[model samples]
Target: MNLRWGVAGLGRGASFVEWLSAIDGCEVVAVCDVSEAALQRFDGLQTYSDYSEFLEKSHLDVVAVITPGPEHATQSLAAMEAGCHVLSETPCVYSIEEAQAIVDVARRTGLKFMLAEDYIWMGWCQNLKKIVDAGKLGDIIFAEAEYTHDCRGGMLVDADGKHYPASAWGSREDLTPTWRAADLPPLFYCSHTLGPLLYLMQDRCTTAIGLNTGAKVAPEVCPVDMESGLLQTAGGRAIRLTNGFCIAHPFSLFTGLYGSRGSIRMVNLGGLQVKAWFEDDPDGGWQDLAMEYEEREDGHHWVTVMLEEFIAAIRADTDPPVDVYRSMEYTLPGICAHVSAEQGGKVVEVPDLRKS
Candidate 1:
């Protein structure tokens, strides 16, 4: 069954359209954005400046919410209410309240509500999970994940030119206004680094202690504000997540897992290295087990994998790997991490969303 997708937010939605255009069983039947100029890029598809109007008129099976971080909940709820499934971008919702609302609506509607956390679907990350589950990494203990990018220049440009922060794409007049008219925390954009580790471990993060560097290097550039969080899981695993608009570092998104018997580290978008350390001999030192590269013309193709999984879940009548609840679990740490940091590095207990 082909999944008819109505894509929202043309900036990032353009990539989804490009990917769906290539996939056989998926179709971009409708597009929506506040910017007519951006909507004009797509030909022979229904376009709308208002999302509510698009949902009411478009014959869509799924609405892909590729809008900014803050707009996910409202748009997703609207789609679900309109009798369509929703696939939203990472960090599912800006706040726990919004997350709960989306979850409640999905349960009541019995429609698929997936969080597009593509890092968990990366080829290298998936391979690592397989190897670890196969006892190649023995009993896992500690893991570290990082998502660092030097977006100072971009932040400065966006803030000065548009009078909004770098990550505030929704605030752009060209985009639809689905976000709450309130300020958002920085650590909310951290699923890319946290999702992969949680999936590989196959366990929820029970507790988190976060230390935020309350340093606003360029307040003018990042007027929305930002902070970094260091989280420690209940099982004594450590995950350091950093998200800010004005950091002075090269872009990096990677995870390193240390187990009782072996270790594996992956440097995504840098060198694409997935190396494992295993006990080679009883008397000797450890050895490195490297993963062979599978070349894709367009890098990892994570978003494509996510869409494929969504379509397969629809066909199989089962929840996707990154379902609403599972995705919520992955996202909670990011939310709590920010709270922890704001509270002067205090440890915060992540609410058990599975229960309530």
Candidate 2:
């Protein structure tokens, strides 16, 4: 069945138009953004500055909600209410309450709701999943993941909502801090670190405890420079997550999985690099693994693969891989972690929204 699509928030959502237009049986019919300059970039497609008007007039069967993190839940609800299936960018929801609401709306509407989480679909992550499933990783007991992207330069935004380095605020009088810069606890952005690990383990976090470096860097613009979360999964496994977007470091995604018989380390230092060790390795040393997979031909492997899967789920009228429940599994623990950090490392329970 051919699907008509509408994309809200052009900053990141613009990519969806190109992707969906290339996918078979999908048409990007409308684009929406508050920025007229952004809307102008898509010359032929229908465009709207107002979200409600876009939903009402777009004649869409699907909506990709790619706005800022704070708008994800409400935009998803609105899209589902308008009879459009939703594919939302992460972190899907900020709080347990928001997660529960998304689940309720999705259930009531019987619409496909997918969290557009790409990390799990990366080649190395997929490879790790295969190793674990094959028992090569053998009874995974502990894991560590870190997303240490230095975003200090983009902490503050100008009058037009364009981001500039926080260091540039002194040279400009009208600069204001972004919400993530001023109020977002680093742990709240943990989906990138948690989602793939949860997917690989096929588990959900039950409790989380965390701590943060209390605005040690860029104190006036950002609340915390780094935060760490220790999560206990339902399967009696432990996962450690470190998230820091404001520190001085090169952008990186790193994950280490420890198991009874073997271990895996995957890091994205500009490019994917994978290393592993097994009990009977020929030399008993870390073996470097290739990161390329057959799916790389599909263009932007992770994003393309994830989008195609979401579309396939919709076409089959089935739950998406990262459906509402799984999205919460990948997202809510981070919120719990943030609460834990705020409470001086007190353990916080992550609500299973499926049971709510």
Candidate 3:
């Protein structure tokens, strides 16, 4: 069955549509974006500047919402309500109420609702999940994931030395509109750091306490230079997650799992070197591990693997791997953590939207 697909928000949406088109059973039929330049990416496919009209006319079976943080919830809801299953970029919704709305609509419609937290399906992370599933690690008791990238360089000017964000960005050159990313709290973007760990643990965070180093990059940058969350899972497990963009650091995405019988830890910050400790290992010496790619000939690109699974689930009429319930679990904790940080490290309950 060739599932017709529509994509909204041509930022990451361009990459997403390209990938979806590569899959044999998926067709990119319609694309929507407000920017005329972005529309250039979809030449033959239908394009709409208005999202509501795109949903109304596309007749898509699936829609991927890859807009900025604030737009995810509204766009995804409209897509689902229009009879298209959704794959949303994280943090799937900005608020718990939005999360619940998605849960309600998805449950009521019996359509696939997935949060596209591609880090969770990273080859090394998947390997760790397999190890935990095989009882190599008895039970996941603690975990941590770090997502760090210094994005300031890409903000003010392009690599081609073009100034931006100075109010009429594409128009007046001298005045710049406040970039929407300026107010986005660091943890508001924490799904890339926290999602994979929760996905691997298959658990929800019950509470989160947050601490942040307030922004130092610029007056208009993310108001958090660094953000860390101390989270307790629903099963009484501990987890730590950290994300920040203002820091001067190499782009490193890492996850660590500490379990009852054994533990797996990444040895380097940005690199894939890993060390594991188990009861059966003689003298408790560490052994390095790396992701072994079997299914992919192009190596371990996690994003494609994730998209493949999403399409497969739609084809099989099954729930998406990272359903909205689990999506909320991965997202709501970070949302609460952001609240905690703003409230001076007061612990906040990570609401489970599935309840009532």
Each model's C-alpha lDDT? 0.73, 0.88, 0.80
Q: Tens-digit lDDT track for model 1 on 1-356?
A: 67789999888789988988788788899999877878889879999999899999988999999887777889999999998998888767877788788888878888999988876666666677678888867777877777767654344223122334445544554532123112345567778777878788877776666665454664433433345666666567766666654566677766788888888777756567666677644654544446533343346576777788788897787998788888787788788877777777787888766677
Candidate 1 residues lying further than 4 Å off, grouped into runs, are 156-184, 223-238, 280-289, 292-300
State which candidate, 1 or 3, has the greater TM-score.
3
Error of 2 at 221 (Å): 1.3
C-alpha lDDT of residue 175 in model 1: 30
Better of 2 and 3 by TM-score: 2
Deviation in angstroms for 176 in model 2? 0.7
Give the worst 10-residue stretch by lDDT in candidate 3: 172-181
* Count: clashes, candidate 3: 6
The TM-score of predicted model 3 comes to 0.90
- Best candidate per TM-score, number? 2
Q: What's the TM for model 1? A: 0.86
Ranking the candidates on lDDT from highest down gives 2, 3, 1
Ranking by TM-score: 2, 3, 1
Against the true structure, what is each candidate's TM-score? 0.86, 0.96, 0.90
Candidate 3 achieves a global lDDT of 0.80
As for TM-score, the candidate ahead, 1 or 2, is 2
